[model samples]
Target: MDFKYDVIVIGAGHAGCEAAVAAANLGSKTCLITMDMNKVAQMSCNPAVGGIAKGQIVREIDALGGYMGLITDKTAIQFRLLNRSKGPAMWSPRAQCDRNKFIWAWREVLENTPNLSIWQDTVKEIIVENGEIIGLTTFWDVTFYAKCVVITAGTFLNGLMHVGKTQLPGGRMAEPPSLQLTESIVKNGIRSGRMKTGTPVRIDGRSVDFELMSTQDGENDFHKFSFMNDGTQHLKQLQCWTCYTNEEVHQVLREGLAESPLFNGQIQSIGPRYCPSIETKIVTFPDKEQHQLFLEPEGETTQELYLNGFSSSLPLEIQIAALKKIPAFRNLEIYRPGYAIEYDFFDPTQLKHSLESKVIKNLFFAGQVNGTTGYEEAGGQGLIAGINAHINCHGGEPFVLARDEAYIGVLIDDLVTKGVDEPYRMFTSRAEYRILLRMDDADMRLTEKAWKLGLVKEDRYELMKSKREAIKRIIEFTKDYSIKTALINDALEFLGTTPMKYGCKLIDLINRPQITIDNIANYVPAFKQMLDEIEENRKEEIIEAAEIQIKYQGYIERERMIANKLARLETIKIRGKFDYDSIHSLSTEARQKLIKVDPETIAQASRIPGVSPSDINVLLVLSGR
Candidate 1:
């Protein structure tokens, strides 16, 4: 094996996988080293991918030539488009993936990817010389060299898991913690903090009472995470059962609170606010009758199920008692109890927009190690880090995505700009231009940039281009084509929406909330005929994308204009141009924060927590922009 490469990615979790694949595909010789070979892209928390803003991030990953979306599509057992009642901006594609198959699928891609190698080993110490990364030494005492290194250690860094009074040192269930890596990196003058995250108990399906729970079926549609998909479902479809926790369940959890690491002060780190433990949930919402839980299948053949929304760090027996209190789990058998793990995370503010360390050149950070909580967020960072690491090695302009351009961009900007007080999770509300960052248009927004960088394959790039062209045709046809009220009123009234009073362009009718290209096509045969001219494979997806653009054209354009206006602030370069402390007009807080953040542009400065709009104006005036 070669001892040297252009980039080496430590830890093969979602971030490492994307980083390694991205760098390698960009023609960089990349090596992805991990502690275990079988657990690549392991679904440590949940057996699902894409939710809320997370689904948008996954779509962006696919658009930018990352492997997560493709791997997820191949392993997904059940698929659903979340936020269906909402508009296009909130529509997120989620999939219940086969956990084991997900790992196998990711491994298959990593193994076969060009210019990439997978090595099973723990990275112990990163070798830095003169403030630049050179390589790293593994736990097995094997030394490897690289021009750039991305540390995506995840929760493995000094990992410690707790369930009731029992505490164990492990990354995941059985994996050993990477004990020295955090210390080694922290000594490099980078700030680090501890964060807590937990998972729910696995269940034996035979013990679950399906009759007592409401069935949540997956959506069968053309919507999927990756544009590269053949739009075919891979694994056999399965049903997920939804149940709720009653007061009886809460009483048992309350009784066990004395021993819960989260409450008893056994754990000091902060956990994810959005995915709080069952104990936290009960305590936080005392008046609520029940909290929802989903029983998701682990794989096609396995009876093992993941108990979502029941995450806990309470006693194992208490966890069982809580589940048994619920009618569905009356006869519940279990695989393993839920537990919380505390691990090391670096302050993301220490990293640049490219996810490279500000202090150490060419050394990058991604994933949970950057104080983020989900697979989607980690993969987005990995994709960017991998791209930048290659560029850092070979020399090019830093690739920074604006917040309006993508959810990935918003995530990185928030991380590098605001840092995190707790484990960060993405939500639709976080991105201001979410309307422009719709899930259906990830390819339209990002694929061409990736293609130009040589990260996107020609075939995929061509497909994206073809899809875009088809969508444009659909939009144009809708704009030009008109329909009489007599022809469309019956269909509209039948659908329980207002009937048109007069003739209108097809787009104007489709713009109505109740009207959709799919629904309207059924009534207007001519519109359906035009849609049929699109490629058969992605006909539905293209039509939907076109419809979204048409319906939200006004909102999308407004958001785009706002985003563009703010983007001009991005061009006013302020970094390294001012000694913020010397700028007397800037507030003391702004001065301190500006010096600390050292934002590259006035727009980034404005987003920093302590920097006010007035401070931004001061910087703008000082920068003569």
Candidate 2:
């Protein structure tokens, strides 16, 4: 039998779900094919989403009309604003979700999404003609045709899970691996490589000694993953328990290192350096006496608690012995032992900034397929790929984001420019313009673009406009409103900030470290009155946005200037026009990298690994700049 679609997404992981939804919402007939329907958007590794730089990415995804942030908010069992003591730029929102609910939420969205169809089948081959993707063939002997295809196969492609010496063929535990798909694409000129990642064991919560561990409670403030969702608790909130692994635990792990698949020659693929296994941690940090671990609930009703920071592929008996060393886990009864997964990932450098393949037209890759580790990173890439896929079906300019514009931009650009030697994960330090990519203003930065593409609904676009206007009003008011010394001096003294000798602009007081809008409002009647006029639904968000703008105005302006200066090079298009191999003035490495990347702009070309400033000067000379 034959099927046709405008875009075919080959997996139902975070990336595939976002891609299919985005494309279909944009009016394209999109088909999402997965090996299993029950595991849609499976939290195979962890039940939590958004952390550090990843939270910012999820907010950006939300701003772009993707469903990850919304779904996370709906199913989240606990929400915490990470890095609260840091500057606003460093503030990130994280949530521990109900694992089962997360899957159900995504599945419900996919099933109800217009113009999208879900099929339970594994793709065996990708059909291509004249150097462009036509569609794919599933294992069930059904052929599907499309103008474009997004491969979010994740770790499913040639997946191999290892628990010590025992190995299993599965995408996830108990799920079979996807076969033939990797080889089918690799033989078609795209490059492929292997990566390894692992998850910690799940514990029976009833057996855990909560009295021995530190209790980490979720925040009850007005903070959530999605801007559209009000901060309401639908599910029962749960507290995560934190414990430490002692010298005894480390010694047991050390003894089992020889039997570990990661240590042995059984697994050769590179794993995430940032989130290493327990065995790797001990080996890397031999001097540290203890390592911290968090016992997080997988769901509110389920007693299966995920053991964070204890990921390993050590022998099952050794794992059990190590857990017994901790007072809290002395009676640890586990659902399953921790295991490391080795799977195939394609070289992301083989793709364009839009995630489209350079060699194969209308072919895109996202998620683990692009050698990225986190769900937020995968969702961002998927959204871009989905939008581009829709644009590919109907003639339009390709969609791309700048490094300064969004974290998603930095991720894709880094992937295509530097490529990956190991599994790539998002970090706050990775983005050069993070000051401009704060979690607070994701909607301000990207919603208009999403609205222009018809990916965002009218109500959402209106909300963005209202929020923008409200923030502007607050900033403008603070810029003009001067306070009296008599009224605020005592309040300032109470807040522990220096009392003003004379009257100053409202923003001047807010710029002080100890003073916050919430705290200082008691002294400033005019400011409080203005804030009170706002609708209750969006009042806090508007006030926070305004306060951040006022407090970091100087930093924000400076970063914008730097971003604007760097953005000039982005305007110089050289993607298809460059013939670096024919230019003798360029270095050989520069020529090779330039030819390989074929960057869309001079800015992008400047970022490619082997391309130096001298090579960029040569390109400028050739381009008549």
- Highest TM-score against the true fold, candidate: 2
lDDT score of residue 396 within candidate 1: 94
Which segments of model 1 are wrong by more than 4 Å?
A: 484-502, 522-525
Clash count for candidate 1 is 0
> Which portions of model 2 show Cα errors greater than 4 Å?
none
Cα-based lDDT for every prediction: 0.91, 0.92
Tens digits of lDDT, candidate 1, 256-331: 8899998888999999999998899888998988999999999989999999999998888889988999999999
RMSD of 1: 1.7
lDDT of 2 by residue, 349-457 (tens): 8988889999899999999999999899999999999999999999899999989999999999999988999999999999999889999999999999999999999
Residue 124 displacement in candidate 2 (angstroms): 0.2
Q: Score residue 444 of candidate 1 by CA lDDT.
A: 94
